[model samples]
Target: MSWLPNADIALLKKRAVIIQKMRRFFIQRDLLEVETPSLSQAGVTDQHLFCFKTHFVGPEISERKPDPLGVPLYLQTSPEFHMKRLLSAGSGSIFQIAKAFRNEESGRYHNPEFTLLEWYRVGFDHFQLMDEMEQLLKLVLACDNATRLTYQQAFQLHLDVDPLSASLEQLKVAGASLDLGDVLDNEDDKDTVLQLLFCVAIEPVIANDAPCFVYNFPASQAALARISKDDNRVAERFEVYYKGIELANGFHELSDSKEQRLRFEKDNRLRQKNNLPQMPIDHRFVDSLDSLPDCSGVALGIDRLIMLATGQSHIDNVVSFTIKGA
Candidate 1:
């Protein structure tokens, strides 16, 4: 029947076991488990992230005359803002395994709706968090070792170009050599070119024998991570990849209220430029920065992690249902 789940009944059982082990891993470390609302009035303004919008209807539409379409709500792309609010209110060291929603994300490693394992460490930086992440993965996936590389190092080793200083033209040439697709002559931005080349030319080469952590991304690509003090040109961010699949993203949290606001504004401007819908900035989250402790946080895709652990190739093989199946 078309209504049946995509994953076999046996695979579903294995997925449950993985989740159980993950919970135990965090519990032993004394990280408090918490939950936040999946819907919000405000959403992330990141240009690259798209939110699914919905409307609420009251029992009687005419009774509420001021707004007839009810409050426009967004299915949260991540639980980051609400979790950060809790951190601001002094809920130290929290974690959640929650459902997250996104728009325009689907395929081998993505789904419009998926489970996310997000956690925050009160006093840890990106490096310390990476260590914790490694431990968690090792325990859950039964892995022993992981490889580490800087963004520049990964580029140099794989694509043989200095990522930070490479001109747009150089990246275009590299992309052309890879034969991924046409690199239009009009494209001039460094970040855009670098990202395209990284995904096509470099990402596929990451070793599958061990997990990989690519750290210290260029400053421009940092979403919420703080700029590294050691190197102003790079952000204190890292991503985990297993078997050529990106499994998680971690950040040395940026706590500056002004900078956070500026970033949101910049994201909105980019959204406008690209003819994408601009989102409302989460001002409350920005306000909470004053109370948020020095911390590091990460969001991991539960489905992808399970896929890696279970030796599944397609993301749909591990999940009970995919969007199309549902």
Candidate 2:
């Protein structure tokens, strides 16, 4: 029946065990577990992410006229901003398994509402974060080995192109060769084309066998990651993939407030160009960046991880219910 949960009883029990093991893994590392609000006054400006909007009404009814429309709020897409604020306020090494909301996202590997396991490790860069992430995956997937590749290397090995030096025309040609179909339009950005090509051509080849950590993405794709000192064209970012499924995204947190503000403004500009709603910038989060320690953080998809662990083909199989089922 439509009222039934998507997951069976045994699957739900296994899900609970996975969650428990995850908590124990973090607790053993002394990473304090904390909870942050799932709703906020402002939402992320990232052009690719969309936040669900809502209104918060006051409890008082007999009092003076409360704004009938109520105060506008947004459901958080990630707990990253709030957690970073806590880190700036001197809360070192924290982790959270929280509910994150994203508008217009649902598929075999995605859901509008999903559980995220996010954490920060002070004094750790992207490499260190990857090591810790690998350890966590080992415990969950019961795997001992993982492959490592840089963004450049993966592209080179899989697609026979240099991701950094390749021109837009070259990328378009590569995409055409792969039969990706109409990858180039006058309006398409370079990074967008690269991503399209990467997804179809490169991603599967890298992690098809074992869990793989692909690091050092192009600087343009870096959301909050610091640019690499060794190579200005790359950012200190890494993503974890298992069996052709992307499971985690991590960054060496950027601490420069000015740069952070510039990135947010740039995101809004892109949003405006794409005719998407420009989100209100989180000024508090920007201010917190000034004091944010040199740390690394990651957001891992709980459902996708469970899908991989249990050999489930669809995300709905691991979760209790999909949004429609719920």
Give the TM-score comparing model 1 with the true structure, all chains together. Answer: 0.95
Per-residue lDDT tens digits for candidate 1, residues 215-289, read 999999888899999898899999998878888999999999999999899988988988998998888899998
What residue runs in model 2 are displaced by over 4 Å at the alpha carbon?
59-68, 185-187
TM-scores, in order shown?
A: 0.95, 0.95
Model 2 local distance difference test score: 0.90
lDDT of 2 by residue, 1-326 (tens): 88889988899899999999999999999999999999987899998899999877866433334457776679999999999999999999999999999999999899999999999999999999999998899889987578899999988887778989999888787677776555455536888888888888877777776799999999999899999999999999999988889999999999998999999999999999999999888888999999999999999999999998898999989988889888
Off by over 4 Å in 1: 59-68, 183-186
Candidate 2: residue 233 Cα off by (Å) = 0.7
Give each model's clash number.
0, 0
lDDT of each: 0.88, 0.90
